[model samples]
Target: MDTTEADESIKYTVLDNLLVDGKEPGSWGTFITRSEMYTQAAQMNGLISYLAIYIGFVLVVACAAILSIQQLSNVADGSRSYRVLAQIGCDDRQIRHSVMAQQAVFFLFPLAVGLAHSFVALKVIIELVSIFGNMSIGGTVSLTCAIFLAACGGYFLVTYLMSTGMVRAAIAIRYSE
Candidate 1:
């Protein structure tokens, strides 16, 4: 028969060298057991690691956004480079775009490297786990990617907000003069 019927029949059938009577239903009745417990324990560790990495990613993004905001603020506050740029007749829009572009570049560099490293490192780790003759090359990787993309999206949003504030501050300072 099909797998479903064969599997069910095997579960219910007595062994030729019978130990326990197979007439009894499986103990714990579909409930989790010791194996399930260890499996869940391993999964929990992965979840915890994921969460720690997630927190680190958020902190990294926050720091990058803050650094970008501070640099933009310094430029807009008539710093040396600001004076030099104004002498060249670079308008306010140019200044704003320059600030945003710099932020984008800075944010993108570490991000791209981190993403590549995450995928490669995890792939290696999975392979290593299998090579040691213990755990198989199983579990999930796409879950980590999803977490990473969410963090990146949050970073981008924060970058946008910081840029908007800096540009407004620059415009106000420009008008005041």
Candidate 2:
């Protein structure tokens, strides 16, 4: 019989054979074939991955917000220095470049640390998954890294734009005075 027929016919003759003897009695027990177990596991993995991606997106946005706020505050705090630099003949473009450079350095460290942790976590996942059968996570790792980098780039771009706007406003105010 095919798997469908066999699955329909599967019946446990005795509970003792499946469960350890002298165990706590329970009214419910689930028996599934290897194939069924594999299918269920795959489904669970897919669901978990979707949820993880959503959570990651939320975290990336949160990081971007925090960075943007901090950059704006820095502009406020460094207004005098910026004004001095402007008086020293630094154009708005040069000031913007300096601000972006500082922000990039601040962002890069956290990005690197996060990537390292992800790589380590992937390695662990690959090792653990190998217990069941040979599994390759190389492609998965590459794809994940690419997506992460893209997300980071998006966040960086948004933060840079927002920060430069604040700086430009500050510079305009200085020019007015």
Candidate 3:
């Protein structure tokens, strides 16, 4: 076997001593816990937690990918708009604000809608699974909302930087030509 920096061969123990590492599947990030030397189907609602987290990650990434592509297109068109606005009455700050506003709408609309869907879906999941196991609907709901909002905030930040750069470029072109 070609040994790399790390490797662990799976063994046929109860795996209760295992970290839910991807070594185990359906896990990511740094998580470590010792099981009760036994195994269960994760109490249904607990399963729901994992399901929600994974789906949230996937949905966020997919939406970000789409947003990235759409933002590229908008940047191109915004350049023209910014240049023309400059030729008219718009100043640098106004053009920058317009760039920000455009990207804001482009990002915020889908972002809010996606979070709404995630909220409702995760809430339903928690409610549905609570019948089988103890679950904190309120806590998870709030946490999910915060995380979703933060994700959107992060994307917004990135978009802001990119849009600002575009504005600078457009402004520079106007001055040069």
Candidate topping TM-score: 2
My TM-score estimates for the predictions, one after another, are 0.52, 0.77, 0.65
- Deviation (Å) of 93 in candidate 3: 2.2
lDDT (CA) for every model shown? 0.63, 0.76, 0.68
Full-model lDDT, candidate 1 = 0.63
* Model 2 stretches astray by more than 4 angstroms: 10-28
Worst 10 residues of 2 by lDDT: 11-20
| Residue 109's lDDT in candidate 2 | 86
The numbered model that scores best in lDDT is 2
In the range 34-132, model 2's lDDT, one tens digit per residue, is: 678878988987798779877887887688678767867887788778778888899888998998898888888888888788889888887876766
What is the alpha-carbon lDDT for the whole of candidate 2?
Answer: 0.76
Arrange candidates, best TM-score first.
Answer: 2, 3, 1
Instruction: List runs of model 3 lying over 4 Å from the truth.
Output: 1-39, 43-48
Residue pairs with colliding backbones in model 1 are: none
The C-alpha local distance difference test score for the whole of candidate 3 amounts to 0.68
Per-residue lDDT of candidate 3, residues 65-92 (tens digit):
6786688668777687777888898877
